[model samples]
Target: MIQTLKLHSLKWLCIALYLPFSLAAATLVGTPRGWRNIDWLDVFGEGGGALMVLAWTLLILGSRPAGTVSNLIFAGLGLIFVSLWQDNIDEFWIIPDAQLWDTWLENVPMPIGVVILTLGLIRWYQEQRILMAQLSKRERFRREHRSVDPVTRLASADYLEQQLDVELRAARRDQAPVSLLLLDVDGFDRINRRHGVAEGDRLLQALTDLLLLNLRDGDLMCRYGGDRFAIMLPHTNETMAVIMAGELTAAVSHFAYHTHYEGERVRLTASVGLALALSDSPRALMQRADHALADAKQKGAGSHASAA
Candidate 1:
């Protein structure tokens, strides 16, 4: 522990090495009096710069689902924030001329921030490449705009129908089996009434992600209605599809959402209905799944059933 203590002490010592510069800056700012001839342009540039850096920091921290990009942006912004903060303080602090400390604070982070930002951009490029590859592996980013539900930004019923048609045709042509899954959140309307619209919207998005997570890459998922989702699968038989549907129901049942009003967490569950297509349109396949889902709901609200 002695050695570790010494190492940490040294690290902090290095940081303290910059304090003289900070103190000197504070001194300079206190006495820029009667120095109107001093570089006013520099003052304006640095002042505006300080504000911009602060804004960048806030924007980076405020972004949702922040990933590697956010971290990189934060670090870059932090460097700028520190530099500008020091510069702005120096505008009035009257540090002694011989100290040369104020100059160090003003100039150091410029190079450091640029170097760090460059490295971050390099890594960001690599990350984008990996993401693009993953996206291409499953989806062409095909403007499945028709398939997506506009309200929740999830897959739409029409898109589901189109997908079912495509998958069914492909299956029939290859003599492969296809399955359709229909899932509806249990007591969703009651939850909407109790929790308000925002919470209801949150639940729908959460459930969409959960259901999509349980599907294979070859599956096509779409939002069927207000609280219902459908998935179309190729090369899947009834037993296998039913097993997946059961897993989906279980997955959704375990999802607990934290409500804003009471700050209390409540679990949301879904009842599922599955169907297998036998040379049919997307609508027919979905109809079968919907009927089966209705059956599951009638029997019990937290389970799954199927129709062929």
Candidate 2:
């Protein structure tokens, strides 16, 4: 609370000073109305409105951070409060008709305040919508937390298996094709031995990002296990899957990653294996891709093999 007050001290000061100024201005320019002449109903309504506006302003200042929207809201409410306060003062003090400034003060601010308040409300609505979208994205990630790999920040092998099962079922129903690409970083264990484990982890993280950039929108990638990644492509045949595998291997070979401490430029290559599903369970399909990967590794770095 103290921090909030400190942050909005200027706004609070303006409000504090405005109250006394309004009171003094009216008292100086007008004569006090007689007890019989004072309208109690107008006093209650206008005074109550001013107090409510003041309370709203305080709440806004307390809860919201100092920003453009908060300032706009404060300004609008301040004007409304000033107008109501002036109107309430009229019940006690009778200003002559010639004192047009008093009339202007009582009447002018209300409409301008309404306009400003409307704009503030619109902006507030837009702000809330953006906040809600980000919250929704975070909620989705939270629900999928168990299916996420901590190292690469990609989906895990378990997530890949689950999604592959769903896609295989859909493929059978629609008589469409689905393919899988299994990629292994060439000699990843050698890199881990040469550099530190931290550097190897960093490389994997960077590689994950690189591979994602190379993937089509509908494709899904997962960290299948250590030094290996899986890509699931829907509505694709063996030929297109093999083509994509080549592109992915080329992307990895061209990527130059520098170590953190030494800044040593390290070139990398990946071997890719392709498999197209055909009356096979998720486990059987993955096994075929694994066999293809083994064949690619035997052929050497940056090689592509297909078991479709």
The root-mean-square deviation over C-alpha atoms between each candidate and the true structure, in angstroms, is 9.5, 9.0
User: What are the per-residue Cα lDDT tens digits for candidate 1 across 127-246?
Assistant: 867865544312324555555565566657776666677878988998877898888888888988988888888778776666767777667676778888777778898889988988
Error of 1 at 307 (Å): 0.8
How many clashes (backbone atoms < 3 Å, residues ≥3 apart in a chain or on different chains) does model 2 have?
0
Model 1 residue 193 CA deviation (Å) reads 0.4
Error of 2 at 306 (Å): 0.5
In model 2, which regions exceed 4 Å deviation? 1-143
Per-candidate TM equals 0.56, 0.57
True-vs-predicted CA distance for residue 35, candidate 2, Å: 43
After superposition on all CA atoms, how large is the RMSD of candidate 1?
9.5
Best candidate, lDDT-wise? 2
